[model samples]
Every structure is written in C-alpha cells, then in structure tokens.
Target: MTDGVEPGTVRPGGRTARVREAVLRAAEDALTEQGFTGLDLADVARRAQVGKTTVYRRWGTVTGLVADLLQDMAEQSAPRTETGSLLGDLTANARLVQRTLTDPRQGALFKALIAAATGDVKTAAALHRFYDIRVREWAPCVRQAVERGEVPEGTDPHDVIRAVSAPLYYHLLISGGRLDEPTADRAAEAAAMAARAGVFVRVGGKQA
Candidate 1:
C-alpha cells in the first residue's frame, strides 16, 4: 500500500486493473439498484465474482470503496467540449449534464451518491472532489471565452463552468423540475449572460 493513500486508491495494471474495473462496476450496480445503504463488500465481491477477502483487504470498508468509486468516476467522466463560442460550449456542457442526470441508471446512481453524502462526511468529501475534478475539466473553456473578450478579465472560470450545470443538478435533486433540452439551453444561456455581465468576476480575490 502506498503511504498515506486510502485502500483501493492506488492505480493498478493488467490483472489488477481488471479487478478494479470489475469491483467498481459492481459497486455502481449496487448503488444504482440498492443505494449506498445496501452497498456491502461481500455482496460487491460476489457481484464481481471476486473473493470477499480481496475486496475487504483492498477497500477496507464500504466508505473507502465508495470513495474509490467516486474517484474512478471522476477519471472516466467525458472530456469537455469546445464549440468556439462560450454560449455554445456552455450549452454543450449543460446538455451533457442534463443527459447524465436524466439517464435512468446514472440518475439513480447519482441520487444514491448524493443521499449518501448528506450524512457521511467522507462520502460528502468524495462527492465534492468528484465535482471539483469535473469543474476543472471544463474550466478552460471559460478561460478561452475570456481570451475572446466574451467575459470580464477577472471572471472566475470555475464559477462559470459550474453555473452552466447548477440548474440542471437542482432540477435533478431539488424541485424535480423539467430537464429537457430547452431547460439545458436556458441554463447555458443564463450562465453565459451572467458571465458576460461579470456576475462571476472576482473582486478583491472573491466573487463580486
């Protein structure tokens, strides 16, 4: 085990990689079908056709396994899109989030993850890390928009990227509102407009 690293977090290769893939997939299946409360090392081992001892040794606990699962998800998430325009790029991003949140399996999986995060500090941290990775992935697009003079010089790129998907997530987790294409477009439009208006501009090292 690497020093200071959590169990099941070290990158592996060959057969180890295969095992990790199987285990993570099984974890996702458990989360989607039964939520975090139902996730079990032995059950996941059985689902992956691996030895329970191996699962227990590698993941240690369900929380550790879920943390690794979220890390894996962050690494596997789709790369950002570039449409040569801020609004277009934001629209693409919003639509991508909308699609993921609306897909039956993915939607349920996210709901489970979010529910798990609510009362679990480690799970909540893992969830935050996951979104932080995703936001960093798409932050460059907002920077590009700044280069094109589409937004203010001090506008926060990460904030703009998060804005595009915030409403979609709200719809998924909160109001249970519509998540159609039009809704996604509206989200992108609103974010783009806000960015243009400098609503996300940093003032004195903080958002104005």
Candidate 2:
C-alpha cells in the first residue's frame, strides 16, 4: 500500500494501480473541466501518459470508466471517525458529506456521473455501490450508540447514516442550494433529533 493505505487496496504501487489512478485523475479533471459528452477516453489516456490500449483494457467504455471512478472513490474515502457521541460523529459525517459533494472537482465529477447514470446501467450500479459503502461505513457509529443506550434498541443504523446525508445531497444536487458548513450542521442536528425521537426505530420487517 502507498504509505497509509491498508493492504490489498489500490495504492501508489503496482503498475495497474498506478495506471488506474492516473486514468481516474485524468478522467476527473476532464469531466470537471469539460462536460460528459466532452469526456474522451483517448484524451484521458493521453493525459495519463498511458497507452490507449491500457485505458481500453482497464475500462472498456465511458460507463465502465465512470464505474471504476466511483469504485476508486469508495476505496479512497476516509474511514469513519468515532467521537464517542452521536452528535459529534454525525457532525463529522455531515461535514465529510458536505465537503465531498461541494468540492469543485469531486462535485462536478459526480454531476457527470449522475448524468451518465441516466443512460448507463453500469454507472447507476456503481453509484449505488458507492452509497452502499458509505452507508455501511457510517452505520457502525449508530450501532455503537444503540449499544451504549444513547439511542433506543432496534434503531436502524443504516437508515440513521443515510438520513445524515440524504437531505444534504438533495440540496446539493436537486434543490441547487449551497451545501455549506451550516447546512451540514443542520443536517446533523436534524438527524440527531430524529434519532432521539425514535423516528429511525426499526419497524416491522420491511422498513427496517
């Protein structure tokens, strides 16, 4: 692994990993600077300073490239930070979500991916996987809180984690509003309040 990355991850070693990062960075840059239609894998290969064959071999199509990009994002995402309090943990989670969704480069990249997903099943799957990984990562925090009795028993950790970012993303992507730190804090507070009120309690079989 490259310095701090855990083993068996895509880090700064191995030819494939190097090539993948180069291509992903190139793709991210291109997608941010240019629109989705303007994203040329050939250009990405050229910018990455790798052969077109390598790029093609790695990601066969634009959809495939986008999938790999989302996968890389999940892999490179920081692990959840535990602050021993649900509020603190949620604030951290909200801040991370706000920062990622508002970052110029990453935000525009996701916009491109979102547009791509409208026409590409593979891209949609990749986006789902990205959320799944994030949800799983943050769910443990809720579970820990439940175990500590900070929240009631049978609270759905996954739902709690999703609640922290769902409104943030909606405002970011749908409402076309600013995703600022205050908004993050608001989201965190709202989720914390809802959790305290048992809105996230595990229901019968379906909603949990």
Candidate 3:
C-alpha cells in the first residue's frame, strides 16, 4: 500500500513487515469484536500504537486495508497434512476448517470479511484470492492420493479439495447447522467418496 515500497518487496521481519503485523492484528481484533463496518484505520492505528499518518499512507482506505488483511490471512494459513490415505487427509483438512469456523474469534473475523465481500467487488476478489491460496495449500494431498491410486489419476485436485469444505461453509454461512467434528468428518468422507468415484474429476476428460 505504501508508495515506492512495492507489495511483497519488504524484507522479511523488516520495519514495514512489523508495521503490517501490528496493523493486521489490530484489524483482526476490530473485525472480531465489531465486524467489518466498524473497521477504521484511525482505530486500528490507535490499537496498533502506530502513527495515524503511517496507517493512512500504508493502507489508504478501509477497503484496501481489508484486502491486505485477506492477503495476510492467505499467507498465514497452515500447510496440508500428510495422512496415509485420501479420507484421512481430507478428514484432517475438514476438521481444520471446522475448528476454524467454530472458534469464536476466527468465525467472527471470517463472517465479517464474507459479509463485506457481498457488496464490494474488490473485497470479493480479495476473498476469492484468499480461498485460492488456501485451496492450493491442500491440493498436494489430492496429488498424493492420485499417486497412491486412491483417487483417479486425472482428478481435479482443487475441485476435490473445495468439495471437502463446501458443506462446512454452507453450515457456517447458509444452513445454520452444526459445526461439530462429526459433521466435518462426514463432509470429508463424502468428498473422498466422490473423488474416488471420479465425481470430482474434470468433465472435459482432462486432468487439472
């Protein structure tokens, strides 16, 4: 967001990186406690103990700040687990999602972000990018499954990975159902079944 110091140009653990960490943590706390509409750069600056001018110059706008927050979330997401089987790996993935969406702070932050994305195209793009990064993080699990002959070789890894978490999100954002670990396992089991049966493979007879 700053001029001259391009995005991703800051050295790791540098001053700019430290400022981003503080600001983003403050932003996360605000979003968790008061949702997206309550997000303000001044408040974030006060909370982060950084200068208002610095926050202003770094992020420019609330929308830009939210976008940066999403980018940080994408980078901070955990890598995929390596279980011995497809179902094991997917279940682990599903449970990670379940734990996140059920946790009070994490759930509230995501809800605020998702709600903001509904009306803002830029926010929606940022949200999509966040999901893409998260999905890519776990895509390797599907590739391993293919090598182990658990799923079809031509399976679309991203499709299978998304399917595992789709229902859990439905419960969180749409269905208002439970977010229990069992529900997570069921979602994972169903996705793994579909994937093994080639239901998640490309429709065009192509591999992804």
Best by lDDT: 1
Candidate topping TM-score: 1
Better of 1 and 2 by TM-score: 1
Residue-wise lDDT of candidate 3 within 26-49, one digit each (tens)? 999999998888989999999999
129, model 1: CA deviation in Å? Answer: 0.7
Report the CA-based lDDT of candidate 1 relative to the real structure.
0.93
Candidate 2: tens digits of C-alpha lDDT, residues 51-147: 9987776676887777777878897899999999998999999999899888878888878888877777877888899889989989999988888
User: Tens-digit lDDT track for model 1 on 42-120?
Assistant: 9999999999998998888898899999999999989999999999999999999999999999999999999999999
For TM-score, candidate 1 versus 3, the one ahead is 1
Q: Model 3, which residues run further than 4 Å from truth?
A: 1-13, 203-208
Superposition error at 75 for model 2 (Å): 1.0
Reference-based TM-score of each model:
0.98, 0.89, 0.91
**TM-score of predicted structure 1:** 0.98
With a 3 Å backbone cut-off (N, CA, C), the pairs that clash in candidate 2 are none
**In order, what lDDT does every prediction score?**
0.93, 0.84, 0.88
